[model samples]
Target: MSTFQERYAASVMNTFGPPKLVLVKGEGAHVWDVDGNEYVDLLGGIAVNALGHGHPALVEAVSAQLQTLGHVSNFFTTPQQVELAEKLLELIGADAGGGKVFFTNSGTEANEAAFKLTRRTGRTHVVVAEQSFHGRTMGALALTSKEAYRAPFEPLPGDVTFVPFGDVDALAAAVTDRTAAILLEPIQGEAGVNVLPDGFLATARAIADEHGALLWLDEVQSGMGRTGEWFAHLPSGVTPDVVTVAKGLGGGFPIGACIALGPAGELLQPGNHGTTFGGNPVACAAALAVIRTIEEQDLLEHVSVLGQKLRDGLVADPRVTEVRGEGLLIGLDLAEERSAEVAAAALKSGFIINNATPQRIRLAPPLVLTDDDAKAFLAAWPAILDEAF
Candidate 1:
């Protein structure tokens, strides 16, 4: 093992098993390891690096904000904080509809805050989908449906029901007057980028309305132009009562938000939930810069065009049985359960990818990934598969 790897094993928690590489530097959609090995960052820090590595806008914003006013208590608010909240509302189309935002440092914290917001409705039951991944927090874990993640954390905050994903009938049957909220990810990124079936969101909206349950969409991994839109659920035209956003929100900075729309916005009385470093000026400024860059660079359109090309190119290989997801949040299933091998092969070929499952490979490259880099990956893909299979 290398010096850093040995040090990481000794000092860092072994939660992620082992370190893949000791990355030393990054720029654009590429990174360099300690040994000076260059690689295309196809994973993009699991969809968090929207503007890609070492983005000037994100760096400048965070640096400038830190120099100006780094940290502030929730008792006070800054221009950056207020502006980011407003911008999120505008992007989510909740500006005129009356919405409120509670900031957090990560997607898990945002989900935790949203979970508490649901309890304020005086209902403990929340209906979620099978194969959903909310977060690792106890409350968020309860909302997440994976047994592997929840088994050890038993006796979690209860009354969360898991229904078959994209099944309108199962959703309607699962939710009742006791249901506080219905949580789902439009595109299940962690579960190999599973897209929701057509009309599912609209039906979910109707069901939530019928039961007076808040419809909360977890946009943590799929939001912020990752899916060619501001949010993955936007195309459905189903305005959810709550939306959780993070990941690409701050480009590569740590930031997340729990946005409640309409009357649900007022559900959480001030003291019910809070965070210390959630809405700090630096993080807010970073997020604003990310949003601004996405707009100025016309990244949404770029993501759409490039994503389609990637999807088409990936499915061209017979070894790839199926492809899923939207924009840059892509997933493909191999003819065999060789996803791990494929990921290793990709890394060997100077690319980074993820194995969401034994058969599923997920790719969430930076929104600013250059066409040249993509072409190179496409050219290498067939060989990568050959090595894996």
Candidate 2:
């Protein structure tokens, strides 16, 4: 009989390519392959496992909520759904009564909701930064700057312009009277964790304000304390009109949210947008548990300290050309274009990492990552580089 990997290759679409290792179980920051070989999961499922795998709190919350109320149509609401929305608003520092939330099952859907919200401004034009990734859906695809991802699905909803990321002048030049919103990622995660230049986000906010456009930030990868803060843009001190978040929000169970502040919150009326399972009770409960776990455990502070250690350790090797990022969202430049080889070497060395580009290695480990696991990866770094190069 064919193995699971062989079956996967035959049945699954070629979207993500072949599987690396067939993982069977996980706990905290570590996972076990089907053969029982252990591996430290530094990628944390691309930053979605904030509390890591099999956390008791998350498991218990999901179980309890599922038993009580698995799901309900949008025509009705659950207490968990309303509570999660209020909690999210509080965490985002927008609990001032004017902020509103539209929940979805994934980040792309969250962006879709925000996309429709932008259209309600009576302006079709939008200014997006180059190398920005909003989502894969058509509406979000139109705002995305990558040609490869957008080319296959052309005739995308138009009226969107791409400007150079981190260029204040380009952003200022891009927005016009017809611009509905200025959408950006606090740090471009898919483009290899490209952090914005200092004052870049503040400049975008000013430009949007000057043009009477909404400032929308895609925090799908950088929010929920990933950067040792509630949102990556917090350091910029600019409150955006719209913020799209997901990834780690539910800690594994899928959930996404698009938050709009002030008058922007009122743009989406009853008929504008709707989803059948956007705010299901179980998903909301899981999200609440994730958020509460972060607060109770003070994982944000841990991420800040541990991330700095990891970044410094990775860049100490001469083969590492440079390192950039904040908190746990780290990206490094290798001296050679051998990131895929490096990833393979890491896996063989009993760790999991990601190669976002030919020479860029991205690391977004769980916020609850242990010091010992981090130290072990650091110890393996030089050997991994030596083997890859």
Candidate 3:
């Protein structure tokens, strides 16, 4: 092992196993390791590096904002904070004019804030989906359905139920008038990039409306142009009561937000929630740069076009059983459970991917990933699989 890897193992916790590489530099869709080897970063920090690494806009924004006003207590708000909230609300939807935003340092905190806000509705029950991933925090973990993740952290905040994903009937049956909210991911990221069944979100919106329960969508992994849209649910024409976004929101700057729409916006009053660095100027500035870059460079359209190309090229391989998801967020199933081997092979061949499941490989490349980079990966797809399988 390299010295950095050895040091990391000795210093860092084993929650994520061990380090993959001691990356030292990055530019756009590429990165270099400590060994001076280069790679195409297909994971994009698990869909967070919207603007990619060392983006001039992101660097400049963070630098300028830090120089201007690094941080202040929530007692005083900064222009970047308010501007970011407004911009996020606008991107989610125009009807979000009355939407309220609560910023946090990460996706978990965003979900935690939303979880607490649900309790303010005077209801205790929350309906969630099976195989969903919210966060590792206690409140978010309770909302998540994985037994492995929840078992170790027992006695989590109670009154949360999970139903089979894509099964509207099970979801409706699980929800009731006592339900304070129904939390869901527009696209299940950690569960192998599983997209919800057709009209499943519409069904969720209907169910929430039937019981007067708040509908919350966790866009932590799929938002911020990852799915070729601002928010995945926007295409369905279903407006959620609460939307939690992180990951790519700051383009790797570490910021998140829990946005509440309509009357749900008034659920969390002042003093009910607090965060010291939730909307720090530097983070907000970085987020603004990402948003501006996406718009100015038209990365959304690029993601849509390039995603189709990649998906088509990938499925052309007979070894691929099926491909799921949209835009840069893609997952492919193999004919056999060789995902780990495939990931290893990809790394050896100067590419980065994720083994989201035993038989599944996921890719969430940077939105700024160039056409040539994507095309090169596709051209190498057959060789990579052949070498792996």
Best-fitting candidate, measured by lDDT?
A: 1
Candidate 1 yields a Cα-based lDDT of 0.94
**lDDT for model 2, on a 0 to 1 scale?**
0.92
Ranking by TM-score: 1, 3, 2
- Candidate 3 lands at a TM-score of 0.99
Candidate 1 error regions (>4 Å): none
As a TM-score, model 1 comes out at 0.99
Worst 10 residues of 2 by lDDT: 89-98
lDDT of 1 by residue, 19-127 (tens): 9999999999999999999999999999999999999999899888888899988999999999999999999988575899999999999999999999999999999
lDDT, ranked from best to worst? 1, 3, 2
* RMSD to truth, every model: 0.7, 1.1, 0.9
lDDT (Cα atoms) of all candidates against the true structure? 0.94, 0.92, 0.93
Q: Per-residue lDDT for 230-334 in model 3, tens only?
A: 998889999899999999999999999999999989999878999999999899999999999999999999999999999999999999999988899999999
Clashing pairs in 2: none
